[model samples]
Target chain A: MEQRRKERIDRGVKVRSDSIYALMSWRELSYLTVPRLLLIIGMLILPLVVTSMYWQRVISIVCIYALLALSFDFLAHYTGLVSLGGAFFIGVGGYLTAIFNTTFGLPPLVSIPLATVFGAIICTVLLLPCLPLRGVYFAIVTLMYPLVFARIIEAMDILGGTDGIMGIDSFSNRWIEQYLVIIVVLLLLFGLRRLVNLDLGLIFRAVKDNDQAVRASGMSITNYKALAVLIASGMGCLGGACIVHIYMWTGLSLFALDFSILPIAATVIGGAGTLVGPVLGCLILVPISELLREFGTLRIVFYSIILVGFIVFRSEGIMVYGQRKYHQFERWIKV
Target chain B: MNKEPILQVRDVTKAFGGILALNRVSFDLYEGDILGIIGPNGSGKTTLVNSITGFIKLTSGKVMFRGKDITGRPAHKIADMGITRTFQIMRPYYSMLAYKNLVIPLFSPRAKRTGGWRGGGKLGDRDTVSIDILEEIGFERDSYVPYKLASTLPTGYLKRLELARCLALKPEMILCDEVFSGLSMSEIASMIPLIERLQMSGITLIMIEHRLRELFKVANRVMVLNFGEKLIEGLPEEVIADARVKEAYFGSEEAKEVMDHA
Candidate 1:
């Protein structure tokens, strides 16, 4: 009996030790999945493998937009709130970065984070009041923020108004621009993923399931929801700042409804809840949109059809569906 | 007999707009005692539980837990103060599996509902406590798999899972809201032993149950509510025998039928 009890105690200690190892391994796996790091390595190496600047630019823009869509996904999927003002933050980050960089002579590195901070502050102010409402009310309230943002930017001549921000400095080398944009994208992707897997993410999901339940658990649901929106908006703003760095222009057109709606639509199409889903959706859809530019008016029509197709057939979005399919495949392989 | 009560309610009242959900009511939850609360559909049993658990703001009166005034503290805060509750609706995280659903509350700082081994997802300090509780509650390591998808479980397992989730929070007291309302006879039978064991372990419990036989067998004291008012508070035998309690619950012959069935 003594020997058995001793063995039991030993087993218990081993079990706990094993779990600690598992938890650490899970965290390490998450860091490796960073999108920007993967993108950087891919961009640096792909030049040697493929040697096309146009494709590189195309991939770069696709990735930059992917970060924005991923941010929107974090809000819509994780928190269960939809916002149409993603572009509002994106525009805010880009224009502020432009003003700081061109007008005030701030370095790109400092100015970009500062621009995102400004966007986050603005988003928090907007998100706080809108939190009390649910469902379509939230959608309508958030939709208005972008419309108002565009009109405000258009009215301000210092922001370059309808013509947008031009004479923005680009990096001396295209390679630096490519690498910098890739780095930021990867950082936001991995950083946000880590944040989501933390305590805040669980609380956020708790709020998503039942606000009353989270309250019952002794947590304030509203605080976490607002935090999620602010974080997502901040990331969206950062993505916007990156966009301006590459394109070298901040315009009223940058904050258009398409900018707001497309990211959300792409997030939904990519798989709204999972981290990789929106990124993959961005990769797939942005290229399609660019390719359809030759179709002019017909591009919008085609986009609508694609949106409808995803809604009808792949309701969880392409990335989620693909993820589930892959998981199922893995399960089969194991069997 | 002279020991200070762990929980004290002094003429507490709650209103949903113009509707009086709970009238001026008073009760005590003594340390290490199982208190049974029973009422009809509109008898304000859930309302009383909600008010105590901080789901609904009380219109009037005061609730003191551990000699501290906890009148308007939020549900999570109240839970953190060694008070946890399970829902009549039993809101399980549907997207997550049973183990993951259980782990949510286990890993969460506010996991105070039921005790059981909350297996590996993310184990914090609270989760370590949850694991200990899970083991105490007779949840095997294999049972952790059920948490993978909580919504798919049989009703019996769901109740067990919720009970485990609550216990993981390490509450000094638990308020169970209709825990056995919708369960097979075997399920309820399985649950009674768990509750009995918790009571043995010296955890104070306030159970609002319609299952009179189980409530009578388990509760140290019984409190009956009628139309938002406390009709009687007494020992189980006395409360069960009381004519007023019978009238409030089942109107003579109907109550006799209930008694005969039990």
Candidate 2:
């Protein structure tokens, strides 16, 4: 009996340029650099290309979700810390920005950065006791934080209560609003790309692989885990700060469960581990959700169908599949 | 055997709830000696290794390594102090490539201080060092084997990779848990020479084996456990000839097999 199998191999240029000698040729260098540049340029032009005020705002929202998804990917995939705390981080940052803008009389630029930093510190400290546990224990605690915060604020009528903080500062202009997030996304995406290849990233990945072995290597897993949490929360809070500035108001809606759930769904649809895939997933998803706005509440049903379809057919996620295709070519070989 | 024991287990006991898995066991392992721990199933051989290496806390006991009490230290701390062990069930990182599995331990503080497997001066290129360790443990350095994901490797290679992982720490002692199990006759033959080579290179070894014949040949002393208590302890010949050992192992088919091997 004759048999054949599909074999995948890296392309000649990809394999040959596996090392840095690719610098010798413009073709090899461009092969490596073009895709990255295209993404950055495409994102920069997206708002202007759309020309609709509503959709331009959608681009900003997509970038915001992308930031949250990036934080989720870095935490769950790299450190084995599956945080359902996106809303917790978002709420904390949003509230802080609201407080800074209103009470402290800070401008949008200063307040957002202050909110990001202080909010991360607050999140980290509150999350410290839970750091020792992973998996569902961590997830439950994180998922509870937003609900807890919402309940506290509602009952006490603190931080503007259900009415929320009205008249928060807005971005100076729409251009700054769009480009600020767009530029930060590109920086963070590339920064994380580089970070994962560094020594610290290797340790983060090792923590995911076998934390017991990492411990055996004579390092503290708890400390590394804390660092990972800090980095992830910082990203999430930055997104939250951006949201407060864009909306020019803050309320209990900032603590909405959608803020928590959507980033995770985006991560799964785009790809779990690839930092950029979650961003791509958010870009695809938020737009679809907005388009399905015509269907009203049925938007959720269509969304679930798309999510379930992705999980059922391509559970490895789009980026993993796309990455394999881009880096390697497949051919049938006789066995 | 070299004088002054490298490791001493003084009345080590471990109990899980109401079950006493290790009942006040004691032994001494000198530098440059091979100790074989053998027993029937459920005799706590692996538990002893775990307790000593601090994978599990001892219910009551003391473990001394190089004359210092290391009873309750964590596994990694014990490993960092130059004592390393292979899992009875292999725990190689499945997602990583075979050689890449060594990257973490190769970059360990112990590896840096001790100069890793070859005991060189400066820690050279990690990838090259990883491939070199893999090659010494039966991997072909230039072949595609080292590049293969660890999960793809057969049991024999995985066992060798487990040993390779310990070697990456430049361990002074290697606690092997059934390393010879699930291997072909030829594979075991090749592996015997590797074990001898590691001992010759000045690392002490403790092997827990159900494969008594081969184990008895290399082990200078043998300790037998039955129902988590020491049954007999002596030279391998004396242990094999003991009436108590035969009687304790009576119902088990492994008894007749070991007698035939003897």
Candidate 3:
């Protein structure tokens, strides 16, 4: 009996454009550039494109979640740091922005940037002791931070206690607020993409592959891990700082587990390692979440169903699947 | 061919909770020597390599590499000092391509300071240099095998990859763990020349093996280990001829079976 199987290979255009000589033909150049240019253009025009004030605010929230997912992707896929500290980063950044604005009488513009840098330093130094750990130990420590911080703030009542800080200044106006975050997210997404292609990225990947081997190569893995954590925490903090201004309030609610769990779900649904995949995942997820808000509390049940379907059927996630489809072609061949 | 001794292990002892793995083992490896370590299963041949290369912390002893006491230095630190080892079970960066697997070691600081596997495979042109090293170590030049994922390579290439990884460091001494055990006779035969070339190029070696016949062919001197103690160290002929080596390692009946095949 004769048998047949589907053979897959890279498309001619994909192979041609992926090389250094992509400039040789206009078609090959576009084949490579079009998809990326589309993502940039689509994101740039999104606020203007959405038209509804309600959904436009949703767009801002989507970007916030996208930033969080990007942090998760960069650390988990590139450096092998599985961080559950998304809420911790947001909480720290939010409170810092709140303190800077309320305590120092700083405006939104100065406060946000200050919070991002200072919050990342606070997170990095705190997490430095756990740098030697990997896998579940690291995950547990990161997960513990937000919960512990939330309880401490609630119990001690230092930074406004349960009621939290209020009257944090909003961005000067709505347009400034929306575009400010959209542009920063795009800048960070591309910046991280470029950074991962550098020599430092090579060491980060090597540490992920084998920490002992990376050490054998005469590198200090702790320094690289710390650097990666700092970058990721900064991204998460930026999102958190933006959130405080968007809501005009900063509270213990910033440390909610939704911020922790949702970004990971977006990363898994978008694609684990690809920097842009989580952003795309956030774009799809946040809207679906807003629509499912009609179902009230049952939105979680529906959300879990969608997440489970994505995990069970296409566990590689949408971006990996999408990238594979774009680059390769399959055909049935007789053996 | 005698040169200065490059490494010295003195009174090294390792206890794993209760069991003794290496019992006051002492040896010195001169430059340009191929030292074969042979023993039955669980005689601690691999443990000796691990201890000397700093993969495991020593309970007691000194590992003097190039006149410096380097006992309990981390594995990477040892590799940085130009001592590297290949795993018995093989630990290639399974996610990377076969040639790319060479890139990590080639990018290592030691590999950068000293040249990597000759013929100009340095930092700037690493991808090409890695393939050059791979081709030299028996991976077919310009074939899909070198470009293929390390996980997909056949056992022969994987074994050669283990050596290629060590060679990327341009290591002063390489601790090779059972490189020929899983190979076919012809595969082992082809690997011998590559081993000879590495030795000829001035890399010292400590080879751990169960395939005694193939190992005895290249090893200048052989050390027999029995239950974590050095039973004898001599030329391959003397070590192979010793009666106690037969009883302790090969056993009376298994020694006769080894002879029947020879």
Best by TM-score: 3
Q: What DockQ would you assign to candidate 1?
A: 0.34
For model 3 chain A, the run of ten residues with the poorest summed lDDT: A211-220
- lDDT for A327 (candidate 3): 90
The segments of candidate 2 whose C-alpha lies over 4 angstroms from its true place after superposition are A1-10, A99-114, A128-137, A156-160, A166-168, A312-314, A328-335, B1-4, B250-257
- In model 3, which runs have C-alpha deviations exceeding 4 angstroms? A1-9, A104-107, A197-199, A330-335, B1-4, B119-122, B256-262
Q: Give the per-prediction TM-score of chain B.
A: 0.89, 0.96, 0.95
Interface CA RMSD, all predictions: 2.3, 2.0, 2.1
For residues A19-77, write the lDDT of model 3, one tens digit per residue.
88899999999998898899999999988888989998999999999999999999999
How do the residues A162-201 of candidate 2 rate in per-residue lDDT, one tens digit apiece?
Answer: 9999898899899999999999999999999899876678
Clashing pairs in 3: A216-B76
Candidate numbers sorted by TM-score from highest down: 3, 2, 1
lDDT by residue for model 1 over A1-335, one digit each (tens)?
Answer: 22322111223223333443534554444433443455556645643464577777777777667777877777776787877777777787888889998989887777888988987888788679889687778888888887887887667655677888787876668777677766666677778788877756766776677667666555567778888888888887887887887788888877777777777777878887877777777777888988899999999999889989989988988766654543333211211
Instruction: Judge candidate 1 against the unseen true structure and give its global Cα lDDT, from 0 to 1.
Output: 0.75
Docking class of 1: acceptable
The runs of at least 3 residues in candidate 1 whose Cα sits more than 4 Å from the true structure, single-residue gaps closed, are A1-58, A153-167, A190-200, A313-316, A324-335, B109-132, B143-147, B260-262
Determine the TM-score of chain B of model 2: 0.96
